[model samples]
Target: MWEATLPSSRHYQIFGYPRVQTPPPLNKRRVCLRFACPSDLQSRLTMRRRASLRTLLAACLAVHVGCYVVERGDTRVNNHVLREQNLVLEERAENSVHSLIKVTESTSTTIPAPQCVLPPGMAEEIQGYQEVVDRVIDYVTTGDFKGQVYSHLANLVDTFGPRMTGTGELEAAIDWMVEQSIAENLDNVHTEDVQVPHWVRNNESAWMTLPRLKQLHIMGLGSSVGTPPQGITADVLVVKSFDELKKQGLKAAGKIVVFNPTWESYGVTVQYRSQGASEAAKVGAVAALVVSITPFSIASPHTGQQYYSVENKIPVASVTLEDAAMMERMQARGQNITVKLIMGAKNYPDTISRNTVAEILGTHQPKETVLVSGHLDSWDVTQGAMDDGGGMMMSWAALVVMRKLNIRPRRTVRAVLWTGEEQGLHGGIEYFKRHQHDHEQFQLIMESDSGTFTPQGISFSGTPEATCIMEEVLKLFHRINATQLTNPMTGGPDIAVWEKLGVPTGERHLARGLYYSYLTNLLHILNELFFYVFLALHY
Candidate 1:
């Protein structure tokens, strides 16, 4: 008796609630009672006028068995004879659907809608499940996951420092992650080789040679070319955006283009950093300088990769926000500003790296996998803590906690620590190329490379049916306030390959605080562990 109705946008269907059968017209006015608990009633309502009243009642009973409770004469509206109606709950034995009970009656119902519900189970059975979840949460929260994760992360940062792609540090860090996986008792720990580009940012510096003598803090953008030994000294042409630079036309020629775009959001402002160089070079600028990507900076220039035109390649670097603003102020006062820029940044040959992978075999279906992961590589400067270090350790801790709890899910849970993420998801791309044949076996691919501050919810990238299941699963963690689910889960870069293959993917949503204080903050690790435990017990 497997029957289910799905949202129209999706191509697949999930078996859960039974299909609704519309009652035959008692009279001319067929009062349509739309129930909103199942979240898929609208789609199922298309067949309402085809069935008899008795069949409709039977279908409702079978579909919503223990999840809902309907009272007799609940649908009496406009002089319609409403007899006994049963509130059927979508059974959790097959599909867990958590939805609000919203009854749209043509007239009105005297009974109030139910606020909360439990799936059909004996009191003892319900309590038993609750106790197990409670224990899992307690064990994970009380454990030293944060300390262990941070300590290991600190060691990686302190030992290997920057894991820029194609560097020895990145390779060493990958090896160390494998060793840590073994130490944590994770199964099948190994590294898969991935070739990545080598872009080095050697000695770099910027200074105001005119209008005021002051050395500006700067970090050469990755993959940028260097200037001559004498360096380029040119008058600074300040612009708020590429559009303004374009308007300058030939005026930008033989000048150092400096951009001071207002901070909006990372997605919006970071574009200037990514494309500022080529845009400047297109206008015949000798060199390009962009303000740091961070909205607020403490004299630290945030370094990132920038694309360059083959014929228009020129030196480009990131200047501190203060310096960029100072130059803009100087230009406003009609004062000429000249800067001396020198950089040894260069691109070398490609090098080989690896993605660290470990797995816990499933108790039931070992071939199917629930993939949890984060990138192991980072930018060349910062310790890469907040950017993704916290995310990496959080994933590692999930596997450790699952092992500690002696819980093996129905499918294998594989933890992949990716390399070359900062270098443009090269590691993830290679892995997908090698394993794309088995994409169907991937039940889910979860990435946490954003930041691990505090758990908010998960962003899902699958059908509404998957979202419904995730929403219901999250209810168990109401105590932690991490049950929220957003649609079109469009996941992170590492799993983008899998997402294109139609495999459902997701990423843990963390609070805004973690974005700033990522590695330094320890609160998010526990939240991540709680999320993982939930996946283990339920999904």
Candidate 2:
């Protein structure tokens, strides 16, 4: 039998056997114990004692476990402090992520204005022309030319309603423009041949039948195909942009994809119109429909060109805001919807068109030219009154005004009305090719195509020195409220060819907000002064 002892207190021990000898301590105040056997009978007694010792050991272990539990309670307090620190760090990280997302969203939509730099001799030139600026304004305000301008615009819109490329109305509009140019008495009036594509939209309509049946006003996008004569009817899958569509993958197959991206400006919003169809088709979608982006919602569907890759092609179209809203509501209800599309839309072989050019020849440097231009073509939806007709008229008026002012610019000013700008820059590209050899002869090219708004200022393309010179020229227009000068010309579609060919370019600044609303009143005064100034300077 084996017996053991352990310390119980400073002067006591937990004994496994009676009279167990105590061992010497290795260090002062330390205690130890030892076991010894005397005879067989005593050894038997020791065995009995050992059994009792087992019971005591079990009791001791229980006591130790109880003390350890108290120690564990203290450790739990330390763990609580660490947990609270982790929670605070997590909250701060979440806030930072939200702030970054907001900043990224805001910057994506804003349009930045170009920088302006002034040139030497600008002050003197502006001072010399102060009276001329006042006279120009008086001539515009007092003149009753507003009626005539309105009449011209009304005639254009009435004669050509929704004239998409390749339509007879589009050709008629071009012819009418040429007649106007010839009537203006400008020199070198003629047209340069160009080829354009024709796309037609047939009968098309959309509706939500399951959640609620309601007719939707929609128009087929340019270059889209007609549904089978019977039309395609299917469930709709809505996506915010192309990325979301990709994530849906095969789930979108055989369904109509609705793209509902919002855009603050036409420049940024236009991407969905141009690429939504192709992207949807790549994922096996049968068709795609995008919400119209225009702020003015008159139930008028705007149509523009949509590109198709050879491998992925699908029918595409646009719906007015009101109609898009109805579709969204129905989709949210988990009800299936169907659309009827009858697009007579088809692509024809490219056909012939032309870019019109007219000029005011210079006396000393007849070969050197200063160019002014605007595109003649427009989308088929609206009257195109503000888009380019106003630009064309304004440029034409400028030439006449220069003559009236008797200000013969050192270089001859040439005016061009471009065609096929809606498709690709076809007219401009062709012009560059034909006139590439004489590019160096061009001193400057100015364009007006943004909109028929009030005069704002001008932007220039040239050496930094030349841009400064142009800015100085703009100071003369300050009295008329067009004083801002932007660096790096916002070249027009018609004049882009010259710019790309390395010819210097500039764009007239026009007010954007109120100009489109009162274009007629502005044009009349502008036309009157233009011819008066042009003749005075040149003749």
The candidate that achieves the highest lDDT relative to the unseen native structure: 1
Tens digits of per-residue lDDT for model 2 on 1-539? 22222222111111111110122212222222221221111111111122212121111111011101011222222212111111100001211110000001112111212233444655575457657655555554555433344456657767775445687877787788778767867678788888777766656677656555667678778778777776777788877666678888787899988887643334335667888888888888998898775644667666667777746677889877677766777777886777655555677878887887877778778888777777767766656666666666666655654555454555577887777776676777788878889989887777777665466666455665555455556555655556555444543556755655777776664434332223221222232222122221222
Alpha-carbon lDDT of model 2: 0.56
Q: Please state every model's RMSD to the true fold in angstroms.
A: 14.6, 29.1
Model 1 lDDT tens row, 1-539: 12234343322211112222243333222223344433332323222322212222223322212212222223211001011122222222123232212223222111211223444553234334555566666765665543666676677777887778978888888888888789979999988989888998888888898998999998898788899988999999999876688889698999999989765345446678888988998889999999987657778787777776657798999998899999999999999999999998888998888989998888888899988889888888767766677788778777887787776677889988888888678888999999999999998888887665667677566655555555556566667777655434423768866766889888775445214213232233333354453453432
Candidate 2: which stretches are off by over 4 Å?
1-122, 130-137, 144-148, 160-163, 403-407, 513-539
lDDT score, residue 126, model 1? 31
Best by TM-score: 1
Off by over 4 Å in 1: 1-132, 144-146, 513-530, 533-539
